[model samples]
Target: MVKLIHTLADHGDDVNCCAFSSSLLATCSLDKTIRLYSLSDFSELPHSPLKFHTYAVHWCCFSPSGHLLASCSTDGTTVLWNMQNGQTLAVMEQPSGSPVRVCRFSPDSTCLVSGAADGTVVLWNTQSYKLHRCGSVKDGSLVACAFSPSGDLFVTGSSCGDLTVWDDKMRCLHSEKAHDLGITCCDFSSQPVSDGAQDLQFFRLASCGQDCQIKIWIVSFSHILGFELKYKSTLSGHCAPVLACAFSHDGQMLVSGSVDKSIIVYDANTENILHTLTQHTRYVTTCAFAPNTLLLATGSMDKTVNIWQFDTEALCQARGTEDQLEQFTEDWSEEDVSVWLCEQGLKDLVGIFKMNNIDGKELLNLTKESLADDLKIESLGLRSKVLRKIEELRTKVKSLSSGIPDEFICPITRELMKEPVIASDGYSYEKEAMENWIGKKKRTSPMTNLILPSVVLTPNRTLKMAIDRWLETHQK
Candidate 1:
């Protein structure tokens, strides 16, 4: 149901991780920079570059409180940043890994977890800024890890397709082959169940991998009071590897982003294809749900991030407008002015216009209401022209105020106004005095002086006065 609004090109290379706050979106790219952009205007904001990393940044996430951000890079370090000022809060480094693959904050924002290609997952206490523990998984790289919503449990998935669930005591509670290929990403749902049904309800886990499969699992309590795994479903729609998967906060829907350059939305209960979003031009490496479930954010190798909003009501309203336009246009006819007027009236009521085969003569004879609608449409086309003229005038005013030379100024005073005053006799003279001397009271010296050399000013002045008196009588 979500519609794509706009695509923002914020990076020069692959955008690997994207997360959203209430009004802003943060993206980390292989270009080794993190950029924050405004979700409202799609304009880039001042961002802090993570230059400490010598290579690509693989993962970035915002804390639950939206005040801090955590990022992991190929430089084998995980860093915490203050979101408001973009200052580094802490940095945890590992010596063994070539690159850090994933980093995440605990639900309570007390701890940070990071996975590395060296097959080790390290946990750090945010308050102490020290390593809590390091757990190693053999055979393949540790690619994905996440803490449970209650902060009582955590899970990690690796390149060997193994998933391990651990408790707060660092005791491994569940370990198994969750997939046939390397697990790329995993997320826990936010929904909680009653205490008596805790084990049955906690069965919700969504995982995606290089094998082009998304498996949903339910943890069921056994008769012996131990937890057992039950495969609820496998979503297999992506033609290429699935890179990331996340469940909505309510656990009603699931979103998966893939290297196939598409994101898929599925019903959590039936695993039905709800939508296939294919706006990205390259591989969609990451996707995240906005704080509001109505919006989804996607980052891609195309170096763009897109925000989609789900608005069924808005879409329905737009469709209704189109239908109204169609119905009115079909009923319009030239022979019936009343019918034409009715259709035009209906269009006006709906704030739309439908005109076909309109002629200049008919346009000229249109009623005031219809003419106003046409004029409104015409004004829309002239918006750019009006804006350009306003900009030109603003520039001219600025230049004049800054003492720039202009041709439209009076030569003597250098002011932007009309002609100069001239003195004629020993007494202080003005245009009124010169006109009275020539007997043409309204004529200035420039006019009287021109006639004085060729003809008598008295006869010329009398002829002008007779013409002016006759014109004044006719105007009355």
Candidate 2:
């Protein structure tokens, strides 16, 4: 399951974009500065708030090796920074003195691409910090860009809704009208998917735009065929203009943020919505996934960045994937049980559990009495906690076995809903969770991130009753 781990409110103005390295996070803002934070603790770096840009800092990205960072701005310059000292390595000015909107490092980290408001896209050599090549889009401002994993070709998206593909030599390979109004952002998945043939290099690219839709495309290249861009599918879930999109490093998920103040995560392969997250108070301007972890950073016009994390084991259980279920059930060995206990923050019990040789089957049968007498867990509170955790696992197993309907699960907790209540976002959530969320002064819908029109929560009596009936029938 996905969970919000932190909310950073450090930017002074609208956060334009955010990116993650293997260990650090970089966020640029209209406040005219770029902020660095440690991914380990989300603490601001000592030399953070890098402030050389004379205008709004529009975009930033870390190099593949995590040794350098690139930040572009309306100042008409893209600055390369030494990640170690937080010092500027080079400041390359856009040729036409245009506002730079986006910058990205090539997969190999040897080249960087900066897209400018004047439609100029510049390719800069990382080693020499010199201009490698330059090209421009035909129409409106160039706002978005990304490099293919092979670094053979790069794509640029313009405000005029055009997508142009260029090769390393700066030759325009393909151009097409991609969006109706304008293109907001685009990203290339790092992992290539199988095209059922060994000769073709197939990649997936996700692009979102002002038309409130995200489209996926199949980009294929070969020595003989050169390049081909084929329309794969269109995803329509956002009600307002889509602002940003990114693919997870593994290429299994695609996430997009929108003017609707919502972020939707999609199962890239099936083009299915996996989760809808609403936490940003204003329109989401940018989003990115960490290259080395299941972590996501989202920036918004509200000037805050939200960090989200994926619990892989919990997600597997939530999705009830057959293989994952089998791994978590009776098949789990003593070592597996120890690892799981540690993951559950029950490290103190690891010794006890190992000493008792409690495996997965034994874990499933654990109860308060079993914990207190058999395991000799003396503390009543500790026993209750262990029993509760075991019961949760048991419930998950049983639900998977009984085919629990999705509607019975609470979107927030990913558990069977109790006391479901309809919120302003037209989604139902557990009453206590919704109350806790509102109590924290987060007056936004948990699903859409939109401001609540009213704080009033109507009891979802119908859904509650339906869940009750289902549990009664299934529990027996």
Candidate 3:
């Protein structure tokens, strides 16, 4: 039941990408303008329709530290902006007459990497904003790029279905055919080493393609002049090509968006699809979770952005050891199981419900098609187990409606504060806002005209849990 919290409008054309900084939400579009909106008040910043690009902007991203915003456009250039002043800090232009497909910042924020339609990858030093290194791939058209967590290696995917990994020393580590049709997106996920874990399995890469499948790969370093990449698994659910993918901040969940107009959430460790969201009307171009929040933002061809908050709790629990029918045995009578199954209101044409003491009221409401689909596989084996698994999956999804009062919003940002804290003045404010007010503004208490007793702020755990509950129940 994720609800749409807001729909930002201003672009006259297609919205290409949306990115978040510490204080701003930056969006770029085919309108040729990159707009900045305040995360605090949810209002457009003053003088913000950055119009330096002559053509449609293709991608936008904020550096890891949130100090700089970068974008690439069909105009063959990637522009870096100093977000504090809405001014262009530097422009890295390619004269190859092709759209600069994508741009991403290194984990340290010291370097910017971009891939272009001409198959060129350029790295720029953030201090001087000058070209640090230029490299090319043999496949020709580049579509996606990402940096490993250690910032030691970079990966790129091509329209010709090839994936290449490059070392920081300006050398290619591994290049191979990654997808059948071509790669549309790629992301990285890492796992903390535990006892008995394979060292090479610590780093995993997820990539999607026009083949309508997502692949996970195990990445490891080699002692020689290269790295080893091995296929981990293939995920299949989307009917159309998956155009975008992202790993949650903690790397516990992996989400993918497809031209099929749906998004799929997966349990990264088990490769199980936790949910398939089908609320968007057109191609879901991009999807991203808030920095450290459960809130997910998605853009579409329908000229809108949707904020979806998911409850991964139920999915997590289903994976836990607890189960209602865990004690059931094959010898359990059908009459005994019918009592619980009847409550779910599913029946086969064989009148299994009717024979099992199901009332006419429950029997008449049965959805024949859905019942038949699941029951059709019962004859093969494990009829009771199949029924239980189906019921468990259905129980994980829920829908609810609720709203947050204005008192829950932060005073600085009219938008709902995902994290709230209290200052020494005994007033609640968004954590970042309180920090910015005291450190950047060098001001006294925001609530009183006196000097604060302490600059330290305490987490409002009560409010944070309340917000989390609200988001989970009212997810759209």
Please tell me which predicted candidate would have the highest TM-score against the true structure: 2
Q: Per-residue lDDT tens digits of candidate 2, residues 413-440?
A: 7777889887876567888888989999
Candidate number of the best lDDT = 2
lDDT of 3 by residue, 1-476 (tens): 34566777777777778777666788888889888887665688896889899998989999988889999999999999988888999988864667998898888999988899999888888898888998889876888988888788889999999889998765888788889999988988745211111222236789999999898876655333235565655775688999989887778778898999998877675455666778778898887766755667677776666666766576557544113232222223455345434323332423554354443233333344434563343453335443454433332211001134333466565557878886776556799888888877565876456788888998865555545655775567
Error of 2 at 162 (Å): 0.5
Clashes of 3: 6
Better of 2 and 3 by TM-score: 2
Question: Number of clashes in every candidate structure?
Answer: 1, 2, 6
TM-score of 3: 0.67
Rank order by TM-score, top first? 2, 3, 1
lDDT of 1 by residue, 249-359 (tens): 666678999989889987564344567889998898998887754678888989988888877575455445433432333333343322223322222322222333433
Which pairs of residues clash in candidate 1, taking residues 3 or more apart in a chain or in different chains?
A: 203-219
